[model samples]
Every structure is written in structure tokens, then in C-alpha cells.
Target chain A: MVPVLLISFIPLVRGIYIGFTDYELGGQISFSGLENYRIMLQDRFFWRSMGVGFLWTTVVTALQISLGLILALLLNQGLRWTSLYSVLMLVPWAMPPIVRGLMWRQIYSPDTGALNLILTQMGLIDAPINWLTSFEWAIPAIIVAGVWGEIPKAALFFLAGLKTIPGSLYEAAELDGASAFRQFRHITLPMMKPIMAAVVSLSFMWNFNAFGLIWILTQGGPGGLTRLPMLAAYEEAFRYGYVGYAAAIGNVMVIIISLFLFFYLRVQLKERTS
Target chain B: MQRLISWILYYKGFIIAGLLAVLIISVYIAGEMAIRLESDEIQTGPLRFLSLAWQEEAVAVVQEITQDWNQAHPEQQVELIQGTWNAVHDYLITGFETGDIPDIFHYESAVIVDFALRGYLADLAPYISDEMRDDILDVNWASVTRPTGAVMGIPFLAESSIILYNLDLINEAGVIAPTNEDPWTWDDLHIAAKKLTKDRDGDGVIDQWGTAMGLRNSANILMNQSIAFGGSFFYYDEQGDIEVRVSKPEKELIGNLARMLFVDKTMSPSGVGKSGAEMIPGFLAGNYAMVVGIGSWARQQVVENAAEGFNWAVMPPLKAVTQNMGVNTQTLSIPRSCKRTAIAMEFIQFLLSSENTTRLAASDWMLPTRQSSLEDPRLQADSTGWKVVTANAQFLSTGPWVGLPGYIEWKSRVANPIFQEFFSQRISLDEAAERIESESNSVLARYQVRGLKW
Candidate 1:
């Protein structure tokens, strides 16, 4: 356990140290002091990406968890073909991120894409929108792609938590004259609090670092509308060869996620005490 | 023993398998490296070159040259590894990082600027005999030479933009061909575009159009239009840093001309109901009368369509832009890490030799980089399409694109979006220009890569 943790921590430590230094891979490294971090503060793209990261996580996590919990609640009712729908819905989550990204790219393609073709025929739009190219549409388009691949996993997690919730509790609430919505609020919400916390945190972290779908669909384009911290970090490190600066971006992402986890924990603690 | 086995099993076979695979593969690679290193001591072996020539035909042409080199000099053979354009950077970067760069590799003009700035490419000034250097035409040399006074790469192949017009469509419109001696101006082109555009089926929608300009990746095309109206792109002063000198007239020219294509509806929309790659077919189908394309596509699509009795002609850019000028250069250079520099140089010299150049020109339509090969009789004897490519070779200019270290990235990242916004009518010309300047400046400031002044 110690060895495994230490091994992982080594890269983290090294990355932190490298972020402060002027490390250009295969080149010379000098002490750049706070230059990289200072630059990070001023970079509009970095801040824009941070904003994007926040929006992406909040929206995707909320949508997935809410949709997932609702679906799980209905499925928990022991409805017909519940197992079949659950199994079928799991396919997207089973797909690799790269495949999901590529599949979405084709679907969003402006020319002869299945989505546009169908939408045009259905008279939903007068013209095929450049979903991946329009600044107004690029972020939402990326979110849709991310959520399409993620909602399934959220469903499975909630479903798992659903199984743990004793059915007798719901029966007990019903006998007390609590309505259906009230029963859900009283029995299901309280019972699934810990599971919800887990799902939200996991989804937040995962969506915060989502790279493949954004990269494939928009590549941080339409004037940096879809740029994320990960994409920015990658461009800095690999494309521009600013190893330290890229590492700094990575470190910043850690701090951002840490804050999210902090707020999440605070909420959970309040829930527990109450 | 059970505990040890359990610990091993806990890893899911990843560690043991990974280490074993690495060891075996490293040993095989080491053995191959040992033989190659040993051979290098006795003789210069096959000089390997990496190039972005993914297509079979392109690779075959390169192979033909290497085979000839091998036959001529049995002592020193040549090998070429072909990779797609996207993978070329990865292969080169990995090689450079590991100190395993190829002897010779090809780079496009803009990328050469970045590679040269980072000191990855060899400064070829010390190389090549004075006479050999003198023989390379100045224009072709400009395509590879750094504006910062570094001769980084040898120009191997190049293409410049040409105005490809469907002659049949023009004649059908009762419009006489612009005299071959004196071509149409931008005003004339605009007028013709307005006329050529028609609702053929009376469906109240444009069917046949004057031009088909792809708005998605159309900076170079738009820049060329701007240049035709006497606009300037990138230029630097004696200080070797970029000097913002884009003229007001040029800015207006670019913005107004781009509007002619986008807002004015003379050209197809960015994805105008089809992909950018599909434009040629659309043009051939009489959907568009003209398109601004390079010699490569003009020959492949326009000229090839002639066999089906669809004749096409090339028109020079309008006045102020005396000739077709846009970014097009495929060059060869040795990386600094290359261990086989001498052999690579030999191969390059052999390639530039008149005989090989003639052979290459015979096989492909690439504009010859050598002065002696320019007058190669085989070029004249080739088909009308090839002859058009050859004749345009002289007046074809390449520049205004290779003025910065991060030039290609600037174009792809900064300028592409600005142009996209412009085409989409999402931003005004002034706003687009401001964004272009600031974004490009920000990138340059962030990277701190240096560029040279011409």
C-alpha cells in the first residue's frame, strides 16, 4: 500500500516541482520562479477554460445525476423490462472515451451527419447549424456529447444505491399517508444521500477532466469557446513544449477540483449532522 | 510462496507482462541498432528519410528516386518512411527527444518556421556548394529560408494558388474567356460571380454559383484575395521581430472580398450543404463555375474532368496581385540529431541532380526546385494540365505565410477562428482584426519563440 501510494505521489511531487521550474522536455531547465504561475493568472484562455471546466462539470454532473436518479427510481419500482432497459443503456458507458468522442464527432458533423439530416427533414431547423463551430453552440454541443456517454454510468451507480434502499421504507412512508412525491422526498432522498454524494463527486471529478470529447468535437475551437484546462495543458506541454507551464495548468486543475470537493464535503457534513 | 504469488496476482498481470514485453522489445531493437551502428563505422549505409507522403502514389514516386539512388551508388542506399501529416510531428518530436531523428525529413513551409525557431532543423547555409545554392531560384528559396536569415531547408516541391474556372460554364453564360494575355480583375471577377450565380430550376434558390470557397479553413484564400487588392500579411523590420504593417486598404479588401463569398452568397457557405473536400465534385457538376485552388487539385479534378469533355482553364490573380501567391512549399531538411547527415546530404544532392529531377518531374507534377530542371523537355512534352502547372510555376509566389516562428499554429488557431467568425457574420471586420492581432500576439508572447525579418 505504501509503495503504491508513494509511486503515484512521486509523479505528483515531481510535477509540482517541475511546474515551478523552467522545464522544457529534452531541453534545459532553469528556475523560472513564479513566471509560469504569473502568466497563468493573466492568460484569458486559461481563465476561459477554467470557466468552461466549471460549467461543464456543474451541468454534466447535475444532468447525469438527476436523470440517472429519476430513471433508477422508476426502475426500482420493479417495472416491466427494467433489466433489459438497464442493460441496454449501459452500452454507452461501456464504450471507450475515444470511441464515444469519435461517434459524437460524426453525429455532429455539419455535412451529411445523421443528426442534421434527420433534423432538417423533420423541419426542426431551416439550416444545418455548425454545432461544433459556432461559439454559442460549441459548449452545449460538447456538453451533450459528454452527457450522452456519462448518463449511463450515473444510472448504474444510482441503480446500485437503489438496490440497497430497503423496499419496506417506501411501504412504511406510504402507510403514513405520504403522497408519492412526498414519499420519494422523505424515503428515497434520505436513503440515497450517501450514494448521491458519491455519484456527484465522482461525476464532478470525471467531467472536470473530460478531454477526449471536447478535443474530438471542437478541438477548443470557434475562438476558444470549448477550450478546457486539460486541452490547454496538453497544448502547452506537447504542442508548445512548455512543460512547466503545462504542469502549472495541471496543478491549477487540482486546486479547482479540491475546492469542488471541499464544498461537496461541507454539504455532506451538514446533511449528516442534520 | 503463496503470499508472493498472491501479490503478483493482485497486479492483474500488468506489471510482469509490461516489464517482460519491454525487455524483449528493447533487446530486439538494441540488436537492430547494434548492426546499424556497426555498419556505420565501415560504410555509409542506407540513408533513411521521413516524409509526410501517406498516399500510395506519393510514396511510390519517392521510392522510385531512392531506388535510382541505390542503383547509382551501391555503397550508399536510401530509404524513406512515409507517414501522414498529423503523425509526422509526433514521429519527428519523439525522434528528436530520444536523439533518433531521421537523416532527412520533409516539412511544409509554415512548420519549417516553427522547427527552425526551436533549433530542431539544421542550418543548411554551411552546406551546399556556392554554385548549387546560386542555382536555386530566389522565389523557391524564399519558401524554405527563414526570414531571420537562416537557410534551414532545401525546397523540394511547391504549389501556388490558381484561379480554376470552368470554361464551358463561362461560354454558356455568353461571357467570352478573359483574354489569356490579359486576365480579369477583381471587379470583373465580382461582376462575373454575380452574373454566373443563377436559380437554374427557378426554385428561388441558388443552383449554379460563381465560385465555391470553403469558409471553414479559408484564411489563406481570403488572404490571397486581400493580397490581390494590394494588401500585406506578415513582414518584419531589421530588428527581426514582427512589425504590424497590415494596411487599412488591405484589411478592407480582405473583409469586403470575404463578404463577397460569404454574405453576398457568391460562394457556397462554409459547409454549403457539403464538405470542403466535396467542393471539386460540386464544381464539376456545374454547381460552381470557378474555385480558387492549387495546381494539384486543378490538375486532378479540373483537367481530369476534361476527358469527359469538361475543359477548364487557369486564370492568374487580378491586378495588384500580379501572380498566383499563397502558401505552398514541401521541403526537405536534416534534423540536428541526425547521425547520417553526410549520407543524407549526398542523397539530397543526388536528388537535385538534373537526371533525377527530370525523372521526378516526368512522374509527378511537383514544381521542380532546381533551375536546370525547370527547362526539362519532358515537362513541356507532358499533357496540357502538366504544362499549366509548369507555366504557373514561375509566377507562383509563396510567402506572407512564413513570417513567424509559430506561424502555422497562428494560422490554424488564431486566424482560422477569426476567419470563421467573419464568414459566419458573427463579428465585424474591425473586431475580427483586433482579435486576430491580440490572440496572435498573446500566443507569440506565451511561447516566446523567435522569428527572423526578411
Candidate 2:
């Protein structure tokens, strides 16, 4: 415990402290109170990235949770090849994020990509669509890739939650002349609310901080349409050598995420108390 | 003895655990000793070299050279660590911060000034011999030599941008192919591009593009073109302070590029986002008639990846107002963190020796920096397009991207985004130039505050 604290905690605290200083990589360090934060507040790129980060997180989380729940419900039906389907669904989650990003990048290639070839062969369009290059479509394309990669994890969480629900409640509701939809609404959804909230909140936080997938795919390019705060901070620290300013961005992100987590914990506590 | 045996029998599990622990420790120590003995046999502790030459052929060449070095100097073997070019800079920076820097390392010439300014690199001027000083190209030599006249690194390989054209497309289109002696001007390229672009199926959509320009290094390529247009991104004042110069000529260059990409539509639609890697397959598939702004080293990639029986030719860099090419030189430097600077210097010298450098250049299709190596027939052979590369080398000018302390930030943050926006037609050329000038000045001001001047 002592060694772990020394290794991880000390650096984390030191990094937070660095937010208050002017610490360029390999340059002299000096304290300039609130200067980094002041610059960040006025920086249009920072705010733009924050907006992108929010949109990415919200869209990806919503899609992932919805798709995950649908898949969980289907898998719970005990259909044929359920085992095979379950295993196959986990494949994307099992793959490394970087590899997934690269794979999707190839698929999204404007020329000779699998997606373009398939779309063309289907006569869906007369020409290839620039999935990653177009400013209007780049973010949505990345979001699709992110959701595809994240759904399995969310499904697994919902699957566990589904298992904990009492089968007797559904059976009783059905016996009382409730339809499938009504049973799910009155019994399943109410029971799954706590788990759903937790999953959504956790997935949102994870997606907000997602870096490798986006970095590998578009590199936040084609006019910074997909430049999230994490990538912006990375560029500030490594490319620009503004370590202190990057740290302040990181701390700001932490504060925002903490607020979300705080509300989530409150909800969980309320549920437990009730 | 009887009492001890009885006690051991009473605590049989403890006795067994103690014995197992002893056996494991003994085995580990023996293994360590054996490894040490093996290393001692080769005397494997002289210089540690971290190289960014991870390409298969480059790695093979490095291995062969290291093997030769090991055999010739049995008492002092070199340890080589290899990484890809994309990840090496971060690794080098992290190594510097953590005091885990290798004795010698390979780096791109663009960031050598930054590292030297940070005091991470040692002054290598004293170690260079007069013969070596004479053999290295003047521009290559000047790249590593600081204003104070201290050479921080030795140039290993150099490359400049050239045009790779599909000869089949050129012949089919009946456009005159560019030559080393008389390369196409910007207007000629535009006309040729229009001639070469075709719609084979006649479905009102073009199936083949006349050319493609990669956006990954678009800023540097734009800088090269602006230089040819007689523009400078920056200039040093009499007091050696840097001033931003992205006004008229830079704006004109961006406008021309925008026309080529958005208006003319002769270039591939993928030009806005695709990297060189993504663009190469399309080029090989005959989707692009020519690939402009490709480094000389891409000749090896073209030879390996192009379709069988694909006929290709190299042309000298295009001209606008003047003919110039962006020279990208790879170099080796000894870090100040190295305890064995003398040995590291020796190893670097060995690596950059005429024969070794020639072998490396041939393997990677890069231009040799050494004058003696440049004279090698293999390097001058027309079959490898070295003739065009060598001829164009005369016009080699390191782009404004080099030697600036905040160059990476300026290029990636300010220049790249603005260029991308212009390419996407979200912003006009004038707006891009204005924003680039202001943002670039802001970046430079940060560096100036840190006492780094042009």
C-alpha cells in the first residue's frame, strides 16, 4: 500500500499541483497562480474541444446503452445459437482499442475500403463517401466505431443486471393478463433502472475520456471536428510543450467528471436507502 | 542430529517450503550468472543506440552493420534499440526526462535544434574529423551546426520531395512526361492533371484521379510550395528575433491548393484526410496518375507495393516561381546524458562511414549525405530514380518547419487546422493566412518568452 501510494498517488497530486505553475517540458518551472486556467478559459479551441467531448460522450453512451439493452433482452430469450451469438458479440470488446480504431480506419477509407466496396456493390450510392475526411461525417463515423466497440461491455453489464431480476415477477405479471410490453415496462424496467443509470453514467465517463480510438482514427482532423478535450490536452502537453497548461485542462476534466459521478452516486444512495 | 531430524519431521511443511525457496533462489542466481557470462563472452557494453529505423530493410541493414561492428570490436559491442519513427520522439523525450536516454540515438533533423536547445544533446563538433567535415553535404552540415558553430549531430540520410508518376497513365493520356532536366511548372502540372483525369465507365463520375496530395504532412508540403513561390513563413531580424510572414504569397499558395482540391477536382477526394499510407494503395491501384510531394524514400515503397508490371517514373520537384524541394535529413546524435560519449561518438562514426551509409541509403532508397557515398554508382544509377533525386538535391532547402523551437506546435496546432479548414472549404484562403499568422505569432511569442529566438 505504501509503495503504491508513493508510485501513483504522489505523481497524481504533483500533477494537480503543476496546474498552477508555468512548467514547460525541459524548461524552468515557475508558479503563476491561475494563469493556466485563465488562458484555458479564453482559448476558443479548448471550449470547442469541450463541446466535442460532450457530444461524443453523450451520443456514444446513448447508442451503446440502447444497443446493449436490446441485445441483452434478445440473448435472455434462450434462442438457438445463443452461446455462439454471445461469444461473437464479445469479439469487438475483446479487441484492443488501437487495433479496433485501425481496423475501422481501413474500413472507412474512401478508396478500396470494405465499406465503400459494399456500399457501391449494393447500389446505395453512385460514388464513394468520404467517411473520415468530410467535416460533416467524420465525427459520426468515429461515434459509430466507438459504439460498436463499447456495446459488448455495456451488454455484459446489462446481462448481469437482467439475471438478478426475479423471473417470478414477469411470470406473475403475464398471468395477470399483462402483455410482453407491459410486463417489461412494469417489472423489468423498474428493476433495471438502478443498473441502467450506473451503466450509462460509467459509459459516459469512459467515452468522455476516450483517446486512443479517436487518436488512431482521424487524429481529430479534417478541421478539428473530432478534437476532444483529451486530444487537445495531449497536443498542449507533448506537441506544444505546455505541460502546466495541459495539466490544468486535465484537472478541469476531472472536476467535470467528478460532478457527474457525484450525481450518480447520489442517485445510487437514494435507491439504496429507499 | 537426531533432535534436529525429529524437529524437521514435526514441521515437514515448513521444511519443504524452505527447501523450495532455496532451490528457486539458487536457480535464479545461476541463470543470472549464465546470462552475465554470455554477455561477458561478447563484451556487450560499449554504446547503446536507439534508432528510429524500424522498416524491415532498414532494420536488416542496421543489424548487419551492428554484427560487423561486434565482430570487429569484440571487446566492445553495441546495443541497438529500435522503434518506429512515429513513436521515437516521445520515447526520446521520455527517456531524457527519466534519465534513461541511450548513448546514441537517431532523430529527424526538424527537432534536433529543439533538443539541442534543451541541452539534451552534446556538442559533436570536436569529434568530427576534417575528412568527415568535407564529405558531408554543406546543407546537411549546416542543419546540425548551431549558430555558435557547434555541430550537435551527424547527418546519416537525406531525402527530398519528388513526384512519382504512373508512366502508363502518362502514355495513355499523351501528356509529356516531366524529366529531371525540365520539370513541370505549377501551370503545366495543372494542365497535365486535367488531361490525365478520366472517367473510364463514363458514368459522370471520375474513376481515376490525376494526382493526390496527402494531408498528413500538408503543412510542410505547403511550406515547400510557398518557398518555391518566393515566400517565407518567417525571417530573422538583425537582432536575431523571428518574425511571422504568412501574408500574400502564403495566401496565394493556399488558394492554388484549394483550387486543385475543391475547384479543379483533379486530385483525389481523399486528399483532405488520407495519410500517405492510405493514399499509397490507391496510387498502386491506378486510381491516381501521380502522387506529388512524396519523399525520395518512397521509391522503395513504390517498388514493393506497386502492382506487378506497373510502370513508374520519378520527376524532379515541381516549380512555381522557382524550383525548390523540401529536404528532410535523418541524423544521429549523442545525448549529454550518455556516460560513454567517446564510445558513442565512435559508434556513430562507424555507422556513418561511407560504406555503411551507402548500404543504408541503398536499402531505404534515401539519398546519402556523404559526398563519397553520393559518388557511388549504385546511388547515381538511373534505374533506381537516383538520377532525378540527385539532380533535385541541388535545389534542396530545408523548409521553414525546421530549427524552430515551437515548430511542432505551430505546424500541428495552428497551421494544420487552418490548412485543413481551407482544404475543406470551411474557410477562405485569406482567412486561413490571417489566422495562421496570428496563431503562429502567438506560439512564437511563448517561445520567445523562454528566450528562444531565430
True contacts kept of each: 0.21, 0.54
Model 2 achieves a DockQ score of: 0.34
Worst 10 residues of 1 chain A by lDDT: A1-10
State the displacement of the C-alpha of residue B80, model 1, in Å, after optimal TM-score superposition. 3.3
lDDT (C-alpha, whole model) for all candidates: 0.71, 0.82
Deviation from native of the Cα of residue B318 in model 2, angstroms: 1.9
Model 1 docking grade: incorrect
**Residue range A1-274, candidate 1, lDDT tens digits:** 3344345766788888888887764567777889889988888778888898888889988999988888787777788999899899899999988898889888877655788888989989756676888767788888888888888888888889889888898788888888999987888888888878878987898899988878877778776677888998987777766788899999888887887788678877877797
Best by DockQ: 2
What is the TM-score of each predicted model, taking all chains together?
Answer: 0.85, 0.90
Candidate 1 to native Cα RMSD, angstroms: 5.8
Give DockQ for candidates 1 onward, in order: 0.20, 0.34
